[model samples]
Target chain A: MIKFSWEFHAAIENYKRMKRIVEFYVEGFTNLPDWARSVWFIILLKLLIMFVIFKLFFFQNKLKKEFSNDEDRANYVIEQITIP
Target chain B: MFESVDLSLVNWSRAQFALTAMYHWIFVPLTLGLGFIIAFMETIYVKTGNPEWKRITKFWMKLFGINFAIGVATGIILEFEFGTNWSNYSWFVGDIFGAPLAIEGIMAFFMESTFVAVMFFGWGKVSKKFHLMSTWLTAIGANLSAVWILVANAWMQDPRGMKFNPDTARNEMVNFWEVFLSPSAVTKFLHTSTSGFVLASVFVVGVSAWFILKRREILFAKRSMVVAATFGAVASVMLIASGDSSAREMAHTQPMKFAAMEALYEGKTNAPLVAIGLIGDPQDDPMDSTAHEDFRLKIEIPNMLSYMAFLKVDAFVPGIKDLILGNKERGIMSYKEKIVRGYEAQQTLVAYKKAKKEKSADEAVLRAKFDDPQWIDNYFKYFGYGSYYDPDPLQLEKNAFTMIPPISLTFYAFHIMVILGGHFFMLFLAILWLLFKNKLENNRIVLWTAVWTIPLVYIASEAGWIVAEVGRQPWVIQDLMTTSKAVSQIDTSSVMLTFFLFAFTFTALLIAEIKILTKQIKIGPKKEGRKQ
Candidate 1:
């Protein structure tokens, strides 16, 4: 019984190993051009750069400007009333 | 997969959103437009020193208060819908969409709610100037709220100032200014705001006309009419102009939608817009000679469709058939196909569970027989199997019964809104003429006409929204995502239960609002000579 169970486990392990080998073989032949890979990397870098620039220049500034305008207007009015 | 397509869940979601949005909108426009009416009335009272104007202001203020209370309640439900029905969409676009909503809560809501309390209850407690300031601030807050909400909606439609992040499976904001300054955003904002102004003004005119007809509170009615009519006339004219511009912008940015609105079946250099026609079954292919038939009754204007769609009478409008064929040839499935596939997948899972327990003569044969492929094939055949040459039964079933809304309702609704808008402009002018001639107060016919026109305001609003939203069916975001794909993975029962609860609460609040408004109208504004 022990010998039979060991044989069954071995069969399952071999099946999984064969499946991995077949998948790797299929993937290895499906090669992309080096230029294409490089282009993809470059595109990713460009996107990252664009994201940073947009966050720093647009989103942050707009929030600052909106809040500042309200604060400034309130302060100016208060100052005018106090002086008068 | 052989599976039964259960559209119950998707249908329920659509119904829930539509009901909530429609009900919320009924109150929203009133708040925006009536806020201005109140501000204008208060301004008149402050400037002219006419006690009659003051009485008129107070009378309208009561109605405005009732609307504001209900509007806030409905608004809370609207915000919750984003998380409930559209959880996935909220998660995806939350980075961008959440900004405007949060700003609305922080900036617009707080400003409006705080000042509204002052405007309502702080008449003598605060200084007169301060109270007046509160009224103006409330109006500003309401308009500002509208601005932020429109900005968010326009972004969804146009997707400006955002880019897809594959890692997050979402679109994130790129430039705040680009989002704010989108052509769709600006046009939609102006058109919506102007429409609100018109609606509010019309309400004031209608109620004041009723009072005039009754011959009670003549001074108050007359004053209210003058203010409402003047604003109504200006807003009515501006609304027409803005609406025209909005349509033109839609033509350039969303040509497919523009084409759908006109029900254009074939691309043409000079398209004659169908003013009135019964669009036959849209579920059938427009190119299928027997499927789509138009019974044309009258043409309102020649080459109007061309002008509205292309800003030029000669520009081409691509029809639905062309769009569908083009997408198919390009290997890009329609939004409806994607949604249907989702439903098919869900149905297949259910079938798999049911088949899991059954035993048959041969295990392999039974498995194949009970598989999802058979039902999927039947579904495809039912929808017309020859539309695509792909023999895969699974794909066919997945794409079966996938169609956008019928073009007839959309086309007619759009035309009705435009025609009514034009007629209202003339009506406003005519009423203004009568008022100037000093016959408005005594002219029962004109007063009755004004009173009756009140319901048309609501109709026009509903029709306009139907055109704007329904025209872009199957897609929550045009060319990017489908509404089915955007819906959250939640139990339909939960949504259905909440839907019933919301409907009940909304109806009860609506009844309460009407009761309060009618009571106030009967009171008929305080008389000038009579002591409070």
Candidate 2:
């Protein structure tokens, strides 16, 4: 009972630490200087273009979408490997 | 069912990946090397208690921040490409390949990101010693990230410590340390990181030269020059050593690539290195074969190639023709023979899978071959080459030549990089001498050369990559998987569209980076009471 209580308190401490770190970064980004804000704009724009436009419309894991399960995916890959 | 692949799709995918990788490389090396340079400047500032040093450190740190922010997500796109364009390759070796990548993300990136935050934002808030420590940690963290990525790349060049699991239709890692500490990985990491250091040194010297020429902040320019020149000179020497090690490793692991780089066409002992040369193009007819291409004009260093490749003056070096045709006396097996053995290996694997599905006794017998080390060494090692096997003799001969990479591109790229490296070493030495004598300001010739060398060093860095990547054509993983076999079953038009999209986005980012940096340079360092 004592060990469990110690472990629970440690976990709570870690969670608090994590929250502080995330909050620090959020504050940093929100209050960036004018020049840095331009760079941040580029970063967000690139990520949006990559994850939203290109990935959503053009790029997909074909085997996962076409084959429903591991067994089917394996069979398809096996055929591709074996047949040249 | 998998008879034909769209050749255009393969070409487009390769082009797209190359574009992104080259663009990503531009920002990464600067980050890798400049991080250390910044840390060094900061350390001096702490030691001397000089605000001028602090001003210099802060200026460089600002430039680093711009580079670090813009370079983000460029590499992440490369990871995504592996899944989206080369799904077969991911499924086949993802077990081994993904481990290093995951570690790079979780450990190296985390360390870099966290400490970098403290380094940039903790200036006044944190203690002096703590800020300095954060700066050093950020540099180390950035380099550690390169180590993992390079190890993964080296595995593709010289694959080791993995087993192909027929049951899973993929390769699995059997030994972690063997993959991590392979000779290729060690040499590649050392060579690549040092080259980054050299490039960053050149960047600093060049920018400082521009300031000196403008007669702006003379003391600051000279001070920065002293550090970068000394650091770069040491790095340049290390670059030569690591470069020599890389060449030796390449000779042992990728002989065909070595041969292509030299444009050698016949196997011989006591081969002379081509110091400079012009090469004629190969004829269209595959069978015309009278030494497919020949040197037009050349200067040779007698017996140097053999010595360089094998540490023996008379050691036999096989060339493009000998590798394709096979040197029976040298015990080099022909590509035709490899294709046959690879076909046998594939057939056995197919038969084993079929028997397993039907619960036949033959499954145990066939599956035992994959388990046997001898069988695997002889045949399964060449399994990917089986895709080129054809019944027709003419086609077989043609397929053999296809194993050779484009000779001229590889040769020229290698030579250009070497020549530029020599120039950089000399340039660094000259700058150090001039700075010591306090003659740097008046020497227009040396200062202008330093200014022009900025773009040239970037060229040399990119050429080095070209030699590494282009030289390893046809195979995504040497002998284990060819590029054609590794590509995804996707529409060519879709790949083409996305390629243009990435090209536009990356170009815009590059322009933005240059503009912001130029503007900062013009603004100069903040005056005593003036806002930056």
Candidate 3:
């Protein structure tokens, strides 16, 4: 924070508008809400579960196991989606 | 010290990015091509009410799903890599390139991912028409994604719809529509997508041929071959047409790449095409620096190069020799001169920034100098050049000629791709003919030929990329910025470490996917399906 202040001060003193704007954004980022910080971790965890864990275990091969043949598969599909 | 550090950083970053792109491409074209083929099969099933068609569609869909997952995985790294490795380039053209990429995610990827769920899981969970629609949507989504990716890549080769903002120290988007509808982008998308289609066709045909060779599922194998051959033949025609137009487009927008591809060293009218190229034997010609001069032996097609480049019999095309050493007669300026202009503009920009920062008495003077239209028209355009002076002092003998990309790689890669393309063209015709005569299954020779050509087609596709990319060396975004300048300011070791990690992971996944896919293919379509 101290180092950033020095850099930000230098830019502000020099009147580097682009640098100033960037520094302001950086400052805002450093103070990001607690919820926002956890959001990153949650997203990362979700992605891991969705792409890796679920893929490896839950979704291996459904087409071959559920039905004996293509027609049986088609019939099973029609039965499920027909709204009873 | 800093120079060497930056150089290593750039090289490592570039190496990682290239490796990832190559790996991603292996799976992507298959996904792009096979997705549509699955849709085609499902459509036939719907129309004919043949359960065999459904079986075929499902089989291909299984393969597509496996490949698509990995392609998606590797592709995520490519986007992140832009920020991690080529951050400078991202900042410079983000205003333009980001739009297409954002649209790709929001529009194409979502549509594809959504329907993909319905296509895969909704088989027994949805009505026949609904499932069919979902499958078609999935295919459309995949192709649409390719279009956006190609557009982003094309913009790098021929930058448009943006103006360099001196104040922001970056390029800013000025016209969204121009960027979206660029002819270069459209042509590139067309050529790239069709190539994927042809690759997918060959893959399908090859797998079917294997089944036929086993003397099992002969009917299913023959029918799949018929569909693939027909699809591939139409795609091959489109591929050739798109390729020709792409060549013309390159000649207009990226003349250096065009010159390197043909190995032409000297500017000329009526330049002959080397139909069969033999390159670089020092015993024959030690002085061979450009494509034309490098050809040790060749069969030339009269005026074809000129015709291809300009759509005219006698149009002039500038080569490496003319572009570097300067062509007085042709009014083609040298790279050295451009470098000088760039350096001057860079110096002025630095001065302007300093003055603006300090707000000193010289600020007005510097601002006035910057405002001069003449300065912007001339020197400012070359502001991206790293040096007006020689970049290396020890290599005093080195000139702009040395900066031209190595011609041999581009030339050979191009020739190999062309040769493979010709092979596919003939093979497609033969397969189509055999299918028409109902003798496809009996033709053992062509069946083997079709089966073997699948991997070779993939090789040809990679070679085509090598030709396009390596042929445009030094430039990451062409004249706008060199690759060295475009790299993120990061340490080399960090990049190298991540590169190997990704390579190992991807390779492992690829091996697993191949094992599973081959096993599934060996199983063939279920015979029990016919009981209905």
Per-candidate TM equals 0.73, 0.94, 0.81
lDDT of 1 at B95: 68
Best-to-worst order by lDDT is 2, 3, 1
Q: Count the backbone clashes (under 3 Å) in each candidate.
A: 5, 0, 4
What 10-residue stretch in candidate 1 chain B is worst by lDDT? B380-389
- Give residue B502's lDDT in candidate 1 (0 to 100): 59
lDDT of 3 by residue, A4-29 (tens): 99999987877887775466455544
Q: What is the lDDT for B378 in model 2?
A: 97
TM-score result, candidate 3: 0.81
**What would the per-residue lDDT of candidate 1 be over residues A1-84, giving only the tens digit for each residue?**
999999999999999999964654444324422322333344344344324532233223221233355334333222221110
* Each prediction's whole-model lDDT (CA): 0.66, 0.87, 0.74
* Candidate 3 deviation (Cα RMSD): 17.7
Q: Mind giving the per-residue lDDT tens digits that candidate 1 earns over B310-355? A: 6888866666555543354434444345334434433333343334
Against the native chain B, each candidate's TM-score is: 0.83, 0.96, 0.92
Clashing pairs in 2: none
DockQ of 3: 0.01
lDDT of 3 by residue, B198-300 (tens): 9999999999988988898888887787788788889989989999998999998878888888888788899888888887653212232333475668898
The model with the greater DockQ, 1 or 3, is 3
Worst 10 residues of 2 chain B by lDDT: B282-291
Candidate 2, residues A3-66, lDDT tens digits: the string is 9999999999999999977877777766677778888888898889888887787777787778
